[model samples]
Target: MDFDLTILGSASATPMLGRHHTAQVLAVGRKQYLIDCGESTQERLIEQKIRFSRTDCIFISHLHGDHFFGLFGLLGTLHLQGRTEPLRLFGPAGLDEVLTTQLRCSGTPLSFDVQFTCVDTTQHQQVYEDAAVTVNTLPMRHRIPCCGYLFREKPGRRRLVKDLLPTGLVPEQLQALTRGEDLRDDVGHVWLRHLDVTEPPPAPRSYAYCSDTVFTESLADLVRGVDLLYHESTFLHEMLERAVQTGHSTARQAGQLARLAGAKQLLIGHFSSRYRDLEPLLEEARREFADTNLALEGLTVGL
Candidate 1:
């Protein structure tokens, strides 16, 4: 299965030269889940050739305009395009009201059902789950009630050892063996030993996202040991005090968080518009975590 993250936009507060806002898509297997819908998200999706029908779920980290202002536009486009599948939206309080008001004022009811789940930004809990993965909320310290998201892929079934299995084994028995379940014949004689017939499943993969929040050491444990981590770095280390006051993180602080969490790789984005060249910010983050990478628009990272 293809597990990767594609960046649509990676700017902070406002769009600039080559950067838009904060938007990303997490593709797992054949499905795609949008993380945030910043400005021109629909255009970005079209530009990237991502089908609107594939995104069944959307996770908004916060109410900040830079993080989710483009959500309504995308939904409207989807409605116009004749999408009938239900969409599951997870976000902080008042999101439903915002979207509803816009739709109501425009007198355009959606063709699809929208299921909204209000998230409690103060708690850590599993908010959504499917056969392939589970999503949890990550509490964050910010100007408002905001939270991040953690995506964990489910463990797969054990692999079968076909060479050792007898040729006459039925499909049902073979399925049991592959699932690591012991199989027996009608007389209760052991037909297959699960351990001997199959190898253990691969470990689950995980990804964490943190955006528009102040730097906090406690977050290290919340996103510990993830395969990939995408965190916001809206300013340079020189503006640490300003970053704290604005409820934002500096590049160096983002790197520190990844290092403390022991993440395999760190992705830094949400750059302040003040920066024309982000080389300094990248250098600052790499000083603390060598595996750090920049979150540029259209960049895709495999997990």
Candidate 2:
């Protein structure tokens, strides 16, 4: 029942001290998703003590170098380590060609199979779904084709309260009760009623990831009432002009999005190198959204 977000890097375009680039690891149960594998993410993963073996799926926001430059090396290392499990990667168009070129030039033969899927930033569509979770893409306001991700956990099956069950019920009978299935004796009779034993599944919990993008009001509904939101605050309010010029958002802008979307909490990052201190940015965002928090490396959040 533990979900966490570990920041691998937090700098935009240019690298800086104490900050690497844009990378995040979202841990949901035994699954780990690497989001935006910027340069140095592998090292950061090792440094942060995140288990690389547990990572099988990765989501990339766009084709920017700062957003996914670390993919090649990380994939190469996973191969060198003799990994046999399949790894799935989701990103924008042309990403497959780019990585394929790199792999060809580097001659890095992988032991595990790698699957790549391109995300259509312009479409509001579900990209991946399984029994455990569903991953969807949100159209974003960026200079290039970019998208955000929304992870929604699937509802759990009805779990029977074991202690409340009638005594001496067979284990198979208990499973049938949990599945809302009726049982029959050798003489042919109803053993369990769906209404008497099972309850509805719990509501799903969700997390939304918004990468480098402007604060566009159109996205408010797509991420409305999300449990947690990771938004890019590349500049402060004073740098509104720069933010507009660069397709970035100010701290206040990020806060406004969080507020309008009705998100429970906001984690802000993807800071510009010009800013040395982040306290002012945090202050500016916190002023508008009290649940706002700075996104730092190794900081984990329960989704």
Best by TM-score: 1
Per-model TM values vs. the true structure:
0.97, 0.93
Residue 78 displacement (Å), model 2: 0.4
CA RMSD (A), model 2: 2.1
Mark the regions of model 1 whose C-alpha exceeds 4 Å error after superposition. Answer: none
Candidate 2, residues 81-116, lDDT tens digits: the string is 899999999999999999888878877778888899
lDDT of residue 281 for candidate 2: 95
In model 2, pairs of residues that clash are none
